[model samples]
Target: MHHISNPSILYFGTPVVLVGTTNSDQTYNLAPISSAFWLGYRCMIGIAAHSKTTENILRSGECVLNLPSVDQVEAVDRLALLTGTSPVPAGKLAKGYSYEADKFKKAGVTPLESNLVKAPRVLECPVHLEARFVSIHPLGAETGIDQIRSVALELKVVRVHLAGSILSDANPDHVDPNKWKPLIMSFQHFYGLGSQLQPAKLASVPERLYRTFDTESAKATH
Candidate 1:
């Protein structure tokens, strides 16, 4: 049973990324965003044209993408309605957005200095990626709406920082899937990954081996 209806928002579950950018005064600005994806060492992030994060990234040419776990959803939600822009755009104001000068303090997240980038990383997040901004491409103009316009930024990963708990001691390159629980945003609501139902047919690993690693990771996390 499926019904086709136009929806207002298209955010149907994506990992939340806390983007850290440098402000004009050399201070760091942390903004929560879900419009991001990675392929190999390159990543693309979609940011609103009026956002301060977009402005900072364009000017600074660097940023840090912090991946928060499901347990940090509360902190991510606290930053939802806040904007780095001081005046608070009229459209954002109508949607209950407010000016937040110190977003890191308001969200109760600690800032850690990054070695490769000027933008600081969120200490609470398990994974931190230091990236160098490459370029920006304007998108979403077919709707004939100015407010809906966004810029897609291309970034090259320079360094990756991960928490030991989320990594596998046996293999440094692999992340223990069972130990990492990324927070997902489904139509503006927060969610965590559910229990595995079945093994994918296309999966390269054998079922028995997959189960073994899954069980081991779960035990290690506990």
Candidate 2:
């Protein structure tokens, strides 16, 4: 049966990404965001207009997108109500968010240096993409937003890091889907990817064919 319905949010599902950025004080800030998508080697994430992570990215132009597996959901939850913004933003404060100076330590994740960016990567996460900021597009500019609340930030992945456990034995460059269980968020709740049900016809195409110039460019990056 079909029926008319409207939900406050349309977040059907998306992978949770721990965005790592360098704060003004040279400290590291990590934010878990689920409004992210990728095409080729470029990824875009939606974040609050005044978030600490956004401020850091705009200033430093570098960040690390860390993908956590299902097992790390506890750590992700610990950061749910913690904001790096000092004094805590008004909206966030109304929602019980408190200022957290050391998100990396609070999340219990170890940091590692990146080759192409100063933003450190989360050692516990299985995947890390050292990225550079490309641009930003404001969201909800009209409809009396009062103020721009969010923006979609584009990023170019300059380097890729992966855990060997998720790589295919047949080809190190390919990720074994069966082995990578990404943490997902749907309607503000955390979940894990389920086992594949059936083979996709799209599997007929080779993943390598979709590789972009950015992938090759990353090889020569420092």
Candidate 3:
């Protein structure tokens, strides 16, 4: 067997996020990106300069992050192909396929008015985050690409909206782990998800727990 290693590669394994923003003219824009995560209660996003999404965000300072489930994967992938900066095909503005206008309809995604932000949320996404722009940082392009400079944003989470199906009326705060399905992206590939492992418990008998923990074979077997 042969192995090779590289350090200067972009190998971040993260979930795909669709950022919804409104243009200066008050038109909606959907940007498919993979550079966002939650830090405590704060949601931070890393965008790139020269992107339509970044431009609209800089102007409006408000946006919504929509987390789509696996069922909406195909539609969300289409949005990634169409750019708001590009010209729309012939004349489909009324039907909602315009380049500068909202593409939610074209992508078969539904929108609902946000509580605090002007940007709307994707009704199909299981998780929705209402965010306020806190800060933006500019970093130069990675490989001399004029349109690929990096922009980091710090956002405050105003509210979190989760699907009712994920919560149990019996224990609301404790979401059904099985129901919290996330789409994982790896090396430009999308996968549904894996099983959820149960957390270590304190109620187990000490001898049994010790044997499980002490044996090296237990780790290898799993």
Candidate 4:
């Protein structure tokens, strides 16, 4: 049975990412965002048009996407209603968000220095991707364009950090899906990945064959 429906927001399950950036004051800011996806070594993250993270990334030109596992849900929860922007923006304030001067402290997460970017990585997270801002794509704007509610940032991953526990025992370079349980967000609720139902036909293709320029670029980068 299928019927046309209009949902207020479409947030189908997606892994949660703690985006780390350097605020203008040279302080660190970590913001948890769920609207993110990857293609090859490039990722697109959707965020509020006026978010402090956005401002920081725009100014710093780099960030760290920290992937917290299901085990860190409590820490991620603590960051849910907090914003780094002082005097919280009207929209966020209306949604019950408040200014959080020290987001890392509020989340009870530790920050570790990143090798490539000024932004620190969340020490509690299982994976960290040091990335550079590639470009920005606006959202919620019509062709005539008056207002832009949000934006999608394209980022190129330069370096990756993975917890050994999440890596495949036989292939340390690869992450074991069964061992990695990412924190997922769906319709404003948190969930963990379930056991795999079945193998996919796509598995027939060698993962190495999909490597792109970004992968090579990562190798050449310091």
Candidate 5:
């Protein structure tokens, strides 16, 4: 049975990413967003036109996508209603948004230097991707709303930084599913991965790697 109810937001569920962009003052601005997706080496992020992140990315042409673990949800949430824009827009103001020039300080996250981009990566995040802005496309206006518009930014990944704890010893390029847990946003709420139900039949993980993981699990249990 399906219920057809119009929901105010369509964020069903998505991995939360902290977008790092350089401000006009050459300072880094960190913003939390979930409307991002990746395909191949290119990633697309949807951001409001009035956001400082969008403006910075357009001018600087580079940014970092920092993937925080479930444990960092509180830090991410602290940045939810804070905007880097000095003059907070009326729409955002009405929604309880405030201006925070120093987002890194407010969120209590350390900024780490990146090799290929000007934007710094969040030191607390497990994964960091240095990317160069490719293009920005204006999205169609919302239903019956001519004043509101959004833009989708396409970025090409230039470098990827992964925490050693999340990397597989068997395959340096593969992230261990057992160790990597991403923070997910579901309809404005935060959630983490539940217990694994079963192994995928067509999993890319090699049999030997699975055996090693299973052996480690058994050893820990004993």
Candidate 6:
């Protein structure tokens, strides 16, 4: 028998992504999100109302999804907690702190140049996705004014970066799913991936090569 959990709000293993956007003033806004995914090479992101991310995409039509790891999990959590519109001069997010134009500095994340997008990639993260906003859907929330139904970002995979330790040239199949540990939210709680049980044809990395990777993707759809 299975017990029914509350549906009021549910948080599951959603990968934490640093959404890189540029404001109307040409200023950069980085919003940390876990509501992002990929279809083959296409990427999609979910954003709330009147957010800098939404505005930036509306104006510039481009963005970057910077993947994070367990070591940066605290920083990722911080970005989710602190509201970007808050009146505080500079505040704390979670593991990372906030600043007017120095989020990268506060979070201790490195920024690398991108070939197709204006926003830079997070050097620390194992994967980076450059995307273009293709469609938007508005969702009605029971409590909030209105939530983002879902935004589909169609992206042409321009580049993919991986850590040296995770990349195995000798064994092209050396790519392991567990290597890129992402933070996923479920029922308002955060959970780390468990492990990679099976290796797919795309890569033949052993299941035990990475600890955190296996922990998270142990039973995930991706």
Residue pairs clashing, model 4: none
Q: Between the candidate structures 3 and 4, which one is better when assessed by lDDT? A: 4
Clashing residue pair totals per candidate (backbone < 3 A):
0, 0, 0, 0, 0, 23
Off by over 4 Å in 4: 143-145, 220-222
Query: Least lDDT summed over 10 consecutive residues: which range in candidate 2?
Result: 213-222
Candidate 3: misplaced stretches above 4 Å? 6-9, 86-100, 140-148, 198-222
Off by over 4 Å in 1: 142-148, 201-222
TM-score of every model?
0.87, 0.96, 0.75, 0.96, 0.87, 0.70
lDDT of 5 by residue, 1-222 (tens): 999899888998899999999998898899999999987567899889779999999899999999999989989999999999978899899999999999999999999998878998999999998888999877875554566568889998777789998999988667888899999999999999887789788786564554333233322121
Residues 181-200 of candidate 4: C-alpha lDDT, one tens digit per residue: 99999999999988999989
What lDDT tens digits, residue by residue, belong to model 3 across residues 1-222? Answer: 877867564746777788888877787888777777876446778875667788887888888888877777887777855667665434334436536355887788888888778987899888888777888766665556565567888877666677897776776534565787766666666777778567657535543334332232212221
Residue-wise lDDT of candidate 1 within 154-193, one digit each (tens)?
9987777889989877876567787899988889898999
- For all candidates in order, the CA lDDT equals 0.86, 0.93, 0.72, 0.93, 0.88, 0.63
Cα lDDT tens digits, model 2, 1-222, are 999998889999999999999998888999999999999999999999899999999999999999999989999998899999988989999989999999988999998989889998999999999999999998988855667999999999998999999999988888999999999999999998778999999999988799878888877544
> In candidate 6, where is summed lDDT lowest over 10 consecutive residues?
213-222
lDDT score, residue 137, model 4? 91
Q: List runs of model 5 lying over 4 Å from the truth.
A: 141-148, 204-222
TM-score of 3: 0.75
TM-score ranking, best first? 2, 4, 5, 1, 3, 6
Assess candidate 1 and give its TM-score to the true structure: 0.87
Residue 129 in model 2: lDDT? 96
Clashing pairs in 2: none
